[model samples]
Target: MSFLIKNKLGLARTGIIKTAHGNVETPNFAFVATHGFIKSLKEEDYFSLAPELTISNTFHLFVTGKHKEIKKAGGLHKMFPLKNPIMTDSGGFQVFSLGWGKKHNIGKVDKTAKNPACVQPVDKSTRPPARDVSKTTCVAGGVRACLPTGRLEKDRNPVKILSDRVIFTYDGKKFELTPRKSIKIQEDLGADIIFAFDECTSPLHDYEYNKKSLKKTHSWAKECLKAKKKNGQMLYGIVQGGIFENLRKESSSFIGALPFDGFGIGGSFGEKQMEEVIGWALSGLPENKPRHLLGIGAIKDIFIGVGKGIDTFDCVIPTREARHGAVYSMEGRLDIKRGVFEKDKKALDKGCGCFVCSSGIKRKDLRILFKENIPEAQRLATIHNIHFYKKLFGKIREAIDSGKRSNLKKLEKHYKF
Candidate 1:
């Protein structure tokens, strides 16, 4: 429950989160450990990649029956042997994206595209259908390799949302994920930071639907706070209003007035509306408390969120994108699998100081790694990309500390959201 801010440059501030496991530096990235572990990397590898915090999915863990195992192992830090702080998402985004998105064949977050074809599948691959080898992935270097998706399969147990609870159907059995239940599960799993259970509506949801959903979110936020036990774990109340400004202000004000430790900016918005809603929410939130913008990790998005006073962020983009050969460069993303890189001798980013780039691995060699389907290739790319994000955020903090906001502005040309 101890969060201290040591410095502020405009809206951006440097801070630390004092948790039972360890302290996490602010203006930091929280990498995704979707099902209680980072994909394609071992627990020890997390120590080397060095994000101050990691986030796990509450819904995924619950569905996969890992929640009980996680608890039995004495919470996430002890189970994973991570010395850093841990955060558990409320499972709202996955409910909206995987369950809700699949039900309607709508896009996960983008609101502009009405056609289902315009929506990109959550998986980026165009390869032919493969077997469902997801559960039988090989363990290498003491880490379980992540399984790639096979044929697009409809979610057998789509999440049915209601005002008080969400019904999840998995394995032919129905499970209810209520606000109170979510809190208890997270408590048992015991992350340093956990979010209140709230409904995360798709960007495709209309204003009327969003308004109705926000009311439920507010009620749940209160319930989550009431259900929280005094265990020194930080509970962040989620703000949900979709893309509407008025609703955003109302939702923010209600959640911000509560004595919760921090705030999580939830729900989805059109790309053009993202900044406005984020600004509105931050305007109403308590400045002394930290704010986490959920499920956004693009470099431009990070810059925008940081500028808007968001203290922390968690996204699957760095590692997920790297697994697909989309890598971050100061110049923007470099798709290593592309033919252009097949014979290119230059490093992924000559200016980068990451292990891969520092080792002088050329673009052609990187392309070969993915082309030949080398397993370590994904891990190396993930490490380098994560390292790149670390460096990027470091630069962001430095720019803010030195009042070089213009440098951040210039970066807009390279990293467009």
Candidate 2:
């Protein structure tokens, strides 16, 4: 069966993206499993998070080893035994992982995927020559990167600045990325669904630059479609055009028309433009296919997108923020590190039914709790944020089940959306 789109509130959706492992409830949050799974959490640990799905990176897995080995060992399900739907990113996000240093500045890259003008002058003798063609950090006009997120982790240079074309040396080796190589890696990974490769234009791009970049991305998406052939596995095209409404409309229409399993609005569109993007997309695209909004999972954002008809959302804020001691609440968030929380407590939240809130009493405020080195604080904090997310969606699912979709808005105000 297709990934089920069960319910809708405004443009946001409460549904299931069914996969071989299981059905991943939609309009969900993703804890960064960038290193395969959350750092300290285990397979059995998922029950507490109760996440509708898990997301990992195709780029990370390929860099570490082959993903086919994962499938052979029973796909990710057997290796991890999480028993929930998992989604794999195509590693397209690395396209903007900027390389910064005195030697490298951000600018338009050429066909070689190298930015020449980003390099600023440095001491000719002390620093590596600006025109050293043999260096791994230069392409055409000559640029370099400081941070390398795209290449094989082994090939990073401590001093090398990582730019689009130039890679840093890790243990004294450099890594390079070409679009063809990325597509091949994703095809081999064999996830239930994979996104097409596209450059993520940061909000910094101007209209002309973003438009040009989106055109290149559109062409690249076509190339990925031509190169990839995954039977039964779905491929979603990403639409990128910063915040410009016209560019968003153009990119959405173009990508939406492509033959694919789904479409993801991947750009600067935020809560303010959620409905605009959705309304624009729905007008030009087919409704049967799923719509994924990259990096959106806040309470208000969910309602805004769902009301506009978005099917799924993935963001690192929930768990990342939670891990840092920030707890999501109805009114806003609790910055657990603040002094106000030192004496306050009361189970993180009174409205939440999560284990953290249910099992607890007050007294272990931030000061005393951290002073005593309590593990419950971290666990309680994560659980509370997770409950806030679940409760937000539970209401949406209930509204959809009852056919009172409009009620989602009435409840959303309490959450500060």
Say which candidate scores most in TM-score.
1
lDDT of residue 40 for candidate 1: 78
Candidate 2: how many backbone clashes?
24
lDDT of 2: 0.60
State the lDDT of candidate 2 residue by residue for 1-417, as single tens digits.
276667554445567766665566665555556655654454555777667766677766765664667656645555664556666776666544332221233322212222212222222221323333323443244433332333323432233212232233323345554445556665565456678777665433456666777777787788778877556567789888766668777888888899978877775543244556556655555677788777667666777777777777777767777766777766478776777776675666666777666766442554355446576565556656666776777676676556665566567666763
Task: Output the worst ten-in-a-row residue range by lDDT, candidate 2.
Answer: 107-116
What overall lDDT goes with each candidate model?
Answer: 0.77, 0.60
Query: What are the per-model numbers of colliding residue pairs?
Result: 0, 24
Residue-level lDDT of model 1, residues 98-171, one tens digit each, is 66455444443564443322222222222212344333322221111113343334324367777788887776
User: Model 1, stretches more than 4 Å misplaced?
Assistant: 105-108, 111-157, 410-417
